[model samples]
Target: MNLQSILSQHIIKAVSESYAATLENIEFQATRKDFEGDITVVVFSMLRTVKGNPVQIGETIGEYLVANVAEVSKYNVVKGFLNLVLSDAYYLDFFTSIQNFNSYGKVPATTEAIMVEYASPNTNKPLHLGHVRNVLLGYSVAEILKAAGKKVYKTQIINDRGIHICKSMLAWKRYGNEETPQTSGLKGDKLVGNYYVKFDKEYKKEINTLVENGFTEKDAKAKAPILLEAQKMLQKWEAGDPDVVALWKKMNGWVYEGFDATYENIGVDFDKNYYESDTYLLGKDFIQSGLEKGVFEKDADGSVWCDLTDEGLDRKIVLRSDGTAVYMTQDIGTAIQRVKDFPDINGMIYTVGNEQDYHFKVLFLILKKLGFSWAENLYHLSYGMVDLPSGKMKSREGTVVDADDLISDMAATAKEISEELGKIDDFSAEEKTQLYKTIGLGALKYYILKVDPKKRILFNPEESVDFQGNTGPFIQYTYARIQSILRKAASASGYTESVEIRNLTLEPKEKELLKILQQFPDVIQLAAGNYSPALVANYTYDLVKEFNSFYQNVPIFGAENPAEISFRISLCDAVGSVINTAFSLLGIQVPDKM
Candidate 1:
């Protein structure tokens, strides 16, 4: 068991014997820096049961703990705070026990599974800066959950069929003389996205022309020839028109190829993908079931809706009056279908923007009202919008920050800054190029993932790529420095992976580093519980800071004895291993020689 668990157990025993108090919960916090202790037990919380002077109660408990616990060498009481000073042998024993730091914090997988859905992008446009946040958050949370011993399935639902999709298709057909992604020398998604923008431009012009000719703006918008044709195309596609279906297949195929490239570049992958074309019609049957069960109400016009008035939400439409499924219907069907596909999956997390927060709330409630056992496990990982330093992005007007372009720009920025700093002097051309991308993408992912998901981000690419402070490059550089130290130590001693030194003394900085390392498993569990990657990201930064302090104040290679040098080298290896593992969880890469 961990030291904290051991301490808690002994402390409870002491309270029961000395104070005769049957306490169920014990609150522990970091020892105040002003106090000479490692962990502080809050004596204030025990006053209800023990009914005595808090200081005296603390002193009695501390005396009992120091007398009984091997790790607890001594203790002190500051008011109601019972501060316990643990022995150095305890830390050394703990460090020696964790032999494989690479997988130290991870737990064995359980039978129950979780499904995390992220990066559900539309085929109409390429991914943007906003999609970056969604994917990073989802991917990191999935990793955190897996580390916490839960089986996880990563997935996405592609928005490949809709009126917006038809707009792009119609535009490509009207404007192009048989141009393809290969012919245009552009990615399929980007080529299709250009047409989507083109359709909006032409549609606006048509609307203005009709309005000038004495039509209302609404009428003009509805009556625009291009939009009407796009609507007709959607109807035809829905009706399984042969030519329209073929065009859609061909265009969507291009988009899938393009999207695959982007997802690969972003270092995220899905185990399965659900398509709108296949799943859009799924929830109709569920709607009928809900209506039969009185979970939903059927209006006089034949529309199906769930009345959420008592739940503080307005009525939500599941099916239209024309017997067509809405997004809500499709979502409900898709969720049920997933359960059918993966019987072991007990929960699902939908990584989506905060704009649809109400949508998810209503969806989850309706599912619960319909009496699905797993409905209670549904969570919407709602995140705020991402804005660039320049301004907000609009995809239709082509002012959006394309994911591919942003990634490339970040790499180029890394190259510029690295060359200016002269940090890659000993690297070959190929190594330099790879390191640049690693550092660049690392910076981007870290800058975004470190912030709380609900907070709006004003992304500054330049600021993010800096090789100092709490950035990804900073942590990566520390890992590289450790790597360099390990290489030198290995060469000097022909070092093996053994830490046999049992009697070596540790400095204050070394003990501080060990203390932070001890918190890794707890941090992983906490991050998973909160479904927050920010917690993991910031924890990693703190670990790096602690390691840096140790590196600065202690001597690793030039230790007083061979045992001390070996122990310090072992500590360095463990820190590097953890840094690599943590970065891997965030989907960021750390270079060995950055």
Candidate 2:
């Protein structure tokens, strides 16, 4: 139903051949302004097996293709490439096609279920800039998949227990810290994080003093019993010791409350939340089950491990030698539990840092060993970390970018920009804040998503995100401008489609512009196929740049011919829809005014 399918079908049918799905790629090329085409098809790629001169083969195929195709007005074989030019008369039909289906270029009957797990954060602290990357990549992946007719399941896992959480609890308890979040005038996560840092400082000093004596640093650190006491606290809560459970529940509630605000602000959500605390025991059971099934082996001292050395991976510990759960154990248990919860699930995906590539590789291998047929469906959407200009962010050195503080800072900057532009003169105070939230969050999400997810990116606050040129705000403003023009055009009196565009006879600028505009569908399919939202990001900017050029060179409303005006308006509508949809897939909201 989309442009590619229609065009591909025409090509295959003319060849007297059939495929389950046709393979066709449409792209823009630069071959000097004198070149007579917009989109170039590499006919050589298809004809290489035939063993002939690519130029003649392209010419023959291009002629045959034009004979079968009605949408394309003409074809030119240039330097062994067959470039097809779409007829201006068929432009309205294509626009009408997209408008009618409401799917735009999304292929029908190509339903795939995708699980996107993003924005997974630890409860010990609020989210940081690192989490923003995870959230953006995960959200964008889900949106891209959904746009391609896939049912996407978004989920998150909270690393809410273990030594990390214990550090905060210990600090809060020992520092005369009966102070609650509200009482201390601090956000929930920040209040808890203060104690986490404090514990590290205090614990390190205690270990240093012990080391200054006869004890080794390692021995002294282990002998201090702080982490042991933290473990005891965890055990007490698990045992339903009333006071310990009360504190644990209260503190975690505040953290969740803070996390909810952050998620809501950033337009990120998950269908399910998996807590390490709840699932660690499930992992233990899963490991024991794997052991009984002859998929795993027992270590000395009653520990459990999975040996993947045969697969060029090191052995992984599941449960500690003391039989307590490790992070890996909890992950294994959660995967199984998720499958059990949703037996109809076609797949599971983990959105985690690239640093954990080895961890997930081992996890999936163990799952496959346990005979889970869906192991092949498991995916690790590993994204690189966001580092600062100085280098990698480290918490102990206090270089970590706290999530709430950073968002607040960005929102304030957005507010300043909005005020400078007088963009919210008509809005209420609360509405103004909402606008700031939208702008700030959209800026952050788009900034993160525009880069290839696999590559490490420096989130330079100054240069990386600018108000003008290829930023989220630029696209939003373009959408708003088109909307304004359309509103004015619609309200204008006595307008009619009075002229015909039999020969496109376009200016060089218009041809260059149309070339990019026509590739929207192809871009969507590529983004979906690759599981990469950067494709969408790149496509949106390309379209915007084309539209900008078109806007400057061509007059829509004041054109001499009414038909030309109407045609231009229709073109604007199509371009606007594609821009909006593409940005939506990148988890960016377009504002009507900004």
The most accurate candidate by lDDT is 1
Q: Which residue runs does candidate 2 get wrong by more than 4 Å?
A: 1-34, 41-75, 101-103, 106-112, 299-301, 422-431, 462-464, 495-518
- Which 10 consecutive positions of candidate 2 have the poorest summed lDDT? 18-27
User: What is every candidate's alpha-carbon RMSD to the true fold?
Assistant: 1.7, 4.1
Candidate 2 lDDT for residue 270: 86
Those runs of model 1 whose alpha carbons end farther than 4 Å from true positions after fitting are 13-20, 389-391, 461-465, 494-496
Clash count in backbone of candidate 2: 0
lDDT of 2 by residue, 320-377 (tens): 8888888788777888888887776677777789999998999899889988888888
Q: Can you give the TM-score per candidate against the true fold?
A: 0.96, 0.88
